[model samples]
Target chain A: MKPIQLQLKQISYSYNGEKQVLKNVNLDISQGEKIAILGANGAGKSTLFTCMNGVITPDSGEIVIEGKKITKKNKIELTKKVAFVFQQPDNQIIAPTVLSEISFGAMNLKLPQEQVLKRVYEAMEYMNLKTFENRTTHTLSGGEKKRVTIADSIVMQPHIYLFDEPTTALDPLHQQMLEEVLEKLSQQGKTILLSTHDVDFAYRFAQRVIVFYKGEIIADDTAETVFCNNKVLSMSNLKQPILLQIQHILMQKGLLKQCNIFAKNIQQFQKLI
Target chain B: MEKHFEQIDYFAYHSPFRKYSAMSKFIFTMTLLLLCLYFNNIAISCYIIVTMLLINVLKNNIKLYDYIVMLSIPFVFVFFGCIAIAIEIHFENHIIIYVTKQTVLKSICVMARTFGAVSILYFFTLSTPIYQMVFVFQKLHIPKILTELMYITYRYLFILIEIQHQIKIAAISRLGYCDIKTSLKTFSSCIANLFILSLKKAQKHYQAMEARCYTGELLFLQEKQYYNKTTTIKATLYILSILLLKIVLRGQAL
Candidate 1:
């Protein structure tokens, strides 16, 4: 069994003491798990992300990171462990150039200048940011900026990366680039979690699916099981991934093999048939 | 508006001097400016102008017409300012436009001084990239806060310009700028909304910065510049020529 990297216990929160954003949330995320949080807009998905990253303190209950309860005092330390990538890459970019943007997190870790440089180069290599070392952040394309922001977190070498709508505005090609990055991170045994509205992406990229509805976790299971469940999909206002829907239709028409498992992507769909 | 900035940035990146250390360029321009001021000779000023024009046109391969157009506005401003002092309105009808020989001489001196100083500065601006300029300041051990402010301001200037263009295009698409009254309303609203959104974005940006362990200091990274012996020799030759030219003109004036 994998070690528990993060744990949340009975977390509850509200805005202005009247509207509850989260209610009795309990979750245990293991190390190296690629999990996707799926929800409709205003479904407390972002709020839960904030709670995990210590951006918003839950009104009730506590969050445990690596066996220690995170509080106002140790929140800064928690940031070193879990880095939150904001929805808008523009908001997260604090440096003028790409290299400095990546180095900001390393320098903040109190690392030596040499170590900072090493980490920056490594992250740049990993994110392909070397070509944009001197390019100003504002001048980068949407895809490049998103990659730079991801590099900003990668340089910190955090145990877990929290992304809020990481693929929101990226084109198809850049989205695939992000998918490759996620695959690489998971292979390195670094836990990755992202809240996304793309059902297809959630199904293909995430190993585990955590569905949220009306500020509560309605389902947490393997991607196949969670996506196959019609009740959970309806509760979260999510449709089955198009690939899965096509697979069902083809199977029913005897045009495809009667496989027990649903295909996650086009490649898988081709292989299963 | 963003297109204008893109043009400037493109020129800066392609500048012939972009390969050299920003410190070297900074030193050259500043030394020339001081020499011109110290000599207080119009010949020296004109010579400096010619040297800068040579570097910008011949070395950088910048179009002479573009350079002239860029400097024309400032040149006109200085000319009018000098003329304002030159003109002595003794009476309503007896308006003496060119008052005296002394006034004309003083006006010419002032205009030459202003143009010399401005031209050297413009040469620096046209030849140096923004990152290199930041490098010069960073090496001088300027305050981190100030350099960060400079960088952030420089970056967001383009973003704001782009946003202004977007707003203008959106307004024009809807005929918001078709009439004088509508144009006024659209521009006013656009400016007001920009302020509101900028403030909101500023706060969000601070939060995002904090998320990545931002602790006030924005660390600057350096790229390797190939400052070799030949480059050093060339820089020395250029500096010696400028100094020699200034001295020769000063001796002629004496």
Candidate 2:
């Protein structure tokens, strides 16, 4: 089996004193796992991602990365292992210029000037932001800003990438581009963990799905199993993709026996039919 | 044609000025301010203003109207000072006439000097980036604590503006513009809400900063290439000539 990349054992946390946001959460992610965190609003998905990235310290239990227990002393080191792409691109972008913003994280690593420039260029190129290296970040469109934030994290080359609702406000085209980027990253053996309410994107991209409801992991299984289970889907405030729903309707009408619910594009949908 | 002029306005050229060293610009403006205090001659102040106007026109290609509007900000203080002194004079304060003349001239001179100072400072800021400015401050051995505060304040200014915009939208959605009294209450509540939102955002930003391995020190990447030597020399000579003219004009007045 692949080496375990991250393991969260009985992790519990709370923003306020009385109410616990996450309780008894146990998850073990191995290398190259593409996991989608599914939840409704106030389901504590953000808190869980924040805890995983060490932005929030758990009240109890342990977080282990590569067999080493994460503590206050090694939190900085863990940052190198896990990179977080925040929900809003504006919050993460500190530099005035695109080039500087992309290079901001690399500068923290204390790398040499040449190395920093090289990595910045590579990241910008990877995100197709090379043309905008000199542009003011504030002047960029929403999709451009999103791509830059992703590029900023990818430049660090972390083993595990955490995306907090990466495609929340993006248009369909931008969302597709993000999905493609995530697919590429997953193919390169990068452990991808993203929390999103976009069930269609999740079904199309994620190999495994974990559902959260009322601050607890309600279900953790493959995409097909999770989408087909009506009970868990209803409780989590989630529905299958539109095509999947249509396919189910056809089956109920005695038009089809079963359907492949993970069709990502029109071509795939055609083949499925 | 108006669009063209607007494009070439003073604020338009501020982008390049933001790249300059803030410490150098700050010291330069402060020195000019001190000199204006020591020399209370209108001729010298006028000379300085003219020089700044010429620089703005020639180097930055700023329009005359834009330049005048920017230069007029300091005169607001002079206008208020003159009014205060006029009021005192009407109260039959004869013994204070000489003092009032001196004060009035000094205020005018201060305003003129401020115009030049603001122009130069604006040029510096419009040309330089904030990171470069912070780096310059750090290299000057300024206290890291103060520089860090400046950095945070600068970053949060935009964030606060965004929050304010959102609050404005929410207020308007709740029919905040229907009447004056209710509008005031809405405005006050919006302001309060903005403060709370800003505080929460600041906390989240702080956590995010720490997650990115921000260890107290605000680090910036140095420019790979040095500034062009010839351009620096030419700009220095241009500024020195203006200084020389101001000194000569003041000496003639004395």
Q: Over the stretch A111-162, how does candidate 1's per-residue lDDT look in tens digits?
A: 9889999999999999988888877677789999999989988999999999
| TM-score of chain B taken alone, candidate 2 | 0.74
Off by over 4 Å in 1: A14-18, A254-259, B1-6, B91-97, B226-229, B251-254
Full-model lDDT for every candidate = 0.83, 0.75
Chain A TM-score relative to the true structure, per candidate: 0.96, 0.95
> Best candidate per DockQ, number?
1
lDDT of 2 by residue, A1-273 (tens): 888989999999887767888989999999999999998998989899888888778999899999999998887778878899989887777765688778777888888978988998999888999888766565678899999989888877888999999998899999989989998999899999999998988888888899998889999999888988999999988998776777778778987666455565567877776
| Residue B153 C-alpha lDDT in model 1 | 75
Work out the iRMS of candidate 2.
Answer: 2.3
Candidate 2 whole-model C-alpha lDDT, 0 to 1: 0.75
Clashing pairs in 1: none
Where does candidate 2 stray beyond 4 Å? Answer: A134-136, A257-262, B1-41, B82-111, B129-131, B222-226, B243-251
